[model samples]
Target: MRNLITFFILNLLCQSLTVNADELTVTLLGTGTPIPSIERFGSSTLIEHKGKYFLFDVGRGATIRLSQIGMYPSDIDNIFLTHLHSDHITGFDDFWITGGIWQRANTLNVYGPDGTKSFVEHTQGAFSLDAFYREKQSSLNLKGLEVNVTEIKEGLIYDEDGLKVSAFRVDHGAVEHAYGYRIDSDRHSVLISGDTTYSENLIANSQELDLLIHEVSVIEPKLLQSNPKLKSISKYHTSLQQLHKLVEKVKPQKTVLNHLLLIGSDETELSHLLETKFQDKNIDVGHDLMTIHLR
Candidate 1:
């Protein structure tokens, strides 16, 4: 009877640990493009796990959305970038400067592609005056303002305290080394496909993804005919049609359409079109500050 009771207690403990191990929530902080929208901000996502925060792609207005969630610039110590596009990295100034002034003790750990270090260096140089002003005013630590950049290739970049982040290369048109990232914990896994056309690497890595956040564009026939410029743009991004094919292959538990570029069709129209194609799967358009919990 004692052995039976011990077995029951041990099983309960194992179940509890498994459930607690992968507690995470993802929030779409910004979901707009370089072409501004009042409703949507730029491209940014926040992953919050066990009081620690990780930011992916800090685009315009990311700090504002972060504010909505009660998170300040200093709260996010780790940031991962998919590529070095202007729209994606524009929030660096807000994050670094605000954090530098407010919470100077924390450090910003940035991970990205080959040019990441150079980009951070130049950005810091641009904000040299601001840093100097803060330094003169207060004896703040200013360490949080310091960005530690790790330029990554197609492999594991971060693994600490039971969470793992892996980076893989993807095709984003003329961009040389764009990437997608897979973040895994004990009970849940997520894949973030930062602006890409279509990637075989993404499909292979996403077999176990609980949630997949991917960039998508709308390419309607009328839009292409109306604006010749869209033809060039279409080559660089994944259309709703292409995304349909991708979702069919990856078959994630849930798929989110992010970095949405609305050319001719509005968000509502585009969503209905995509939903028709993905009738068998769960898919939704991402909006700023939308949060999803993964258990």
Candidate 2:
């Protein structure tokens, strides 16, 4: 009975954030791309450090994913966006409005590359009437409805209270300015590669990292056979074939692949293939609502 009680306590500690105050609490809220899937929501990651909740990207169903881990949209204040891609920022509108409704009294601070301000403005504009109705009809915090936007070009954008974030450029096909983030909090460092096709800049920024959350593009064999044109889409993201080189170069302490392309066969293929190839490396295929307590 004593052992059983200890087991339950350990399980709850692993699932939630009541323990490990000094470590970086990383959660993959959504690991899927624009392609819809019941398993993966979209491209959203939640980072908790120094008692502050920092969200990376607000893709589709982000709020739902957050709720799964006993968190709500209102708990997040700092959100760093990699780019303005539809798959990446589609859930921002929902996170913004719903957070305010749920009592997020502080302003939503958003950091991203150029055109991010315009995107936020347009998103708010599209939901103008709804915001107004809620403001009048409900007991929502007006300040929470407000958002603080920071459009960054490069270099260190955020530095305060032991948190530092650097934004770097990446190659994403036709997109002029897709970026990734290097987030560090004294004890732990994490790199998030938002939709990119193997950028050398990532290598420059990612060194001695505790956790590396990167994207991998792999369309299953059947999907490619059915629609050969879809192969071009892989050009925009780092393919499974090219990922080993990046992993070798960056050589992070740990790697979690995010923004996974759909189809169960491919997920299995990715696991089995990488398991054989990256046998010595600590790598994992991320799933939605997956939590990691970085030590």
List clashing residue pairs in candidate 1.
Answer: 106-144
Evaluate all candidate structures by whole-model CA lDDT and list the values in order: 0.87, 0.86
Error of 2 at 275 (Å): 1.3
The TM-score obtained by model 1 is 0.93
lDDT per residue, candidate 1, 122-204, as tens digits? 98999887778877878655676788889999989998877889998888888998999999987789999998887888888
> Backbone clashes per model, in order?
1, 0
**Could you tell me the lDDT of residue 80 within candidate 2?**
90
Q: List the candidate 1 regions with Cα displacement exceeding 4 Å.
A: 1-14
Over 1-295, each residue of candidate 2 has an lDDT whose tens digit, in order, gives 9999999998998756533555788999999988888898989999888778999999999998988888878888889999888989999999998888888867889998889999999988998888788778884457777999999887898888788888999999888888899998867899999999888989999989999999997777677667756767777888776789999998899999999875535788889888999998899999998889885
**TM, every model:** 0.93, 0.89
Best by TM-score: 1
Q: How accurate is candidate 2 locally (lDDT)?
A: 0.86
